[model samples]
Target: MRVLFSVSSWPTHYSSMVPLGWALQAAGHELRVLCMPSQTAAVAGAGLPPVPVLGGVEVAVHNRLSYVREARAGQWPYPWTPLHPVTGAAMSTLDEFDLGDYLRTDGARFAAASAAGHDTAVEFAREWRPDLVVHDPVSTEGLLAALVAGVPAVLALWGPVGTHEPAPVRILPDDLGDSFPRHGFGPFGPDLIRHVLDPCPAAVAAPVRGQRLPVRYVPYNGPGVPPGRLPRTPGRPRVCVTWSTALSTMTGPHSYALPAIVAALTSLGVETVLTATREDAEALGPVPATVRLLERCPLYALLPDCDAVIHHGGAGSAMTAMVTGTPQLAITFASEQSRLAERIASSGAGRHLPGHIATVETIQAAVAALLQDVAYQRDAAALRRAALDRPSPVDLLPALEKLAAE
Candidate 1:
């Protein structure tokens, strides 16, 4: 079978689909991952064949978030009337949603991702004629490509099924005005996806809606050599402190919070390993002499030896700790991230504080609680078992095949 995988340039997003993509490839299916050129090297590093698509998600998302900031300032990014951009996609005009703020933020995000590679992937799908196309929920271009090619398209959700559903937004590029009729399809939305794959463990995940299918959350931090043997200090409770690699790209209110968190952790006599890219590591200001600051390492490789974790609430980082059964403290920023932190706290596996409100005292308190609280440890361990008990990608292969066959 021919399968095309579409994802945004984000590494964490791409990592979510790696295990499933491998399952299909191992089953003898012809697979090619479609991503922007910025993500090409990382995709190749993951040992997956990457096909470059046209426009880049970087330009798209950057502009979209700028639009969000404008909207928050009470400035309208779009004119009273919509303008025909080069892609001929509508700007500022949006459909009715539960929140008007959502229309500008998530709406812009989806449209940007859709606009970036829509035409390129569609042309490729039309020519290559794949039997199936699987895509990240945030990157909806694959659906357009599948629609154009008249192939089955499935959604591979990156996080909680409920949290990751594609926002209902119309990204109808001007060039594709009459394309739907030609492709024999109507409007596409989250509800239109007949088969949706979810990897969140049931213990922490909300109830699945629609035709959602469950798969085990196999954690992958992408290609990197193991960080040799960990020389964990004797008799010290090790705490992994990270802003994640994604933080290097993040321009958030809490960007400087890491150094404070690190200082507090080390002052408490806990060994703190601060992980991030060199650039992000430098951004953390002065690191305490006691903290071991590593600018790079696969988080999964580091979590196994740790007793607790402190992180900005990137889904990949939080989920990695959860799967490894390590208790955590999440400094959640954006509203979307705040929900994940809340969910973890509700599950009894971790504690979370709002990023903007997290001071040295708060971070120290949260980290200390996770390290000292036995309930958090017990609960995280149980959740890890729940994830392990869920079906693996190999077990999910038959269902994916059945979906494609249908």
Candidate 2:
């Protein structure tokens, strides 16, 4: 069987699918990754064949435009229009506006950006004639190509299911309506997505729609040298601090809280290891002597030795910490992230702090609680076991094979 995988330009989104691609290749199936031209190097680094699409354009262009538009309009970085109290309560107990806002802003923008690659991907799919196409949710081009080619398509989720209230494609702006018909499909709906491969552990995941296939969460932090044997301070707890690589680039420097985070850790006198790219690190003018900063270091390598992790609430960062059984303090600014952070806190494995309220004192308090409390550590261990107990990507081969056969 030939399998084609499509993902967005973001590293976190695409990296989540690498292990599954590897699984298909190992099972004697041919595989090729369809991604933005900018992401070709990253896909290749993961040891998969990359077929770059979207010409030379990058998705970040649209994101930057949206950011500027929001800023100019005096809206939140990524604003959610509040629903009426009566309507909001009627929708569901949890806030549905976040998902609605995501579809309006990020989801719609992503679809527009991805539409640029639609013809290119369809052309590739027609030539390669793969039996199956697996794609992350935002990669609408993948589904379009698969539909055009008359092949089965699986929706692989990065974390928990966030598009449950309204099907993602259904809520897309009308400008995208034409793209669907061009591929011989009507407005996109749940039927177009054959399966949802969920990696989030049940304890922290939102209830999924459609056929749910549970897959173990595997952490792939791009290609990087392992931070060799971190030396621990005797009897002192070590904490890892990371801001997601994409956040700063999307929202700009004003969103950075690492300096405040480090200050809090220093006040508590816990050993702190800060990991970031050179660009992100350079944004921080100077580093204090108390903090050890490593550039381009993989979290999988750094998190195991640390007792707790403080991060911007990115799915990759949260899951990496979870798989390692490290407690977390998630400082989130966006709606999707805030939702995930809430789930993490409720799971007994971590704490969530809204970016607006994450002051130095509060950060310091959260970190100290994670370190001193035995419940957090114990719960984190349980969550780790639950995640590991899920089916491995290779184990899902039979199911995919059956789908392709049908």
For residues 1-406, what per-residue lDDT tens digits would candidate 1 score against the true structure?
Answer: 8999988767786587898888888999899988878888988887789997745335334433543443455543223322222232334442321235654655555455445457778888888889888887655678778877777887776664352322211221222233333455665444555666777776567433447678887788776556766787788899988775644234333345776787688778888887777877776677666688775677888899999998877778888888899998888654345567777878888998876578788878888888887999999998788877878988988877786777
Give candidate 1's whole-model lDDT.
Answer: 0.69
lDDT of 2: 0.76
For every candidate structure, what is the RMSD over all alpha carbons to the true structure, in angstroms?
6.7, 7.0
Error of 2 at 80 (Å): 14
- Residue 201 in candidate 2 has what lDDT? 85
For model 1, which pairs clash?
Answer: none
Pick out the ten consecutive residues of candidate 2 with the lowest summed lDDT. Answer: 166-175
Once fitted onto the true fold, the runs of candidate 1 whose alpha carbons sit more than 4 angstroms away are: 56-116, 161-188, 206-208, 246-249
Off-target runs (Cα >4 Å) in candidate 2 are: 55-58, 61-116, 165-177, 189-191
The best candidate in terms of TM-score:
2
Give the TM-scores of the predictions, in the order they appear: 0.81, 0.85
Against the true structure, candidate 1 reaches a TM-score of 0.81
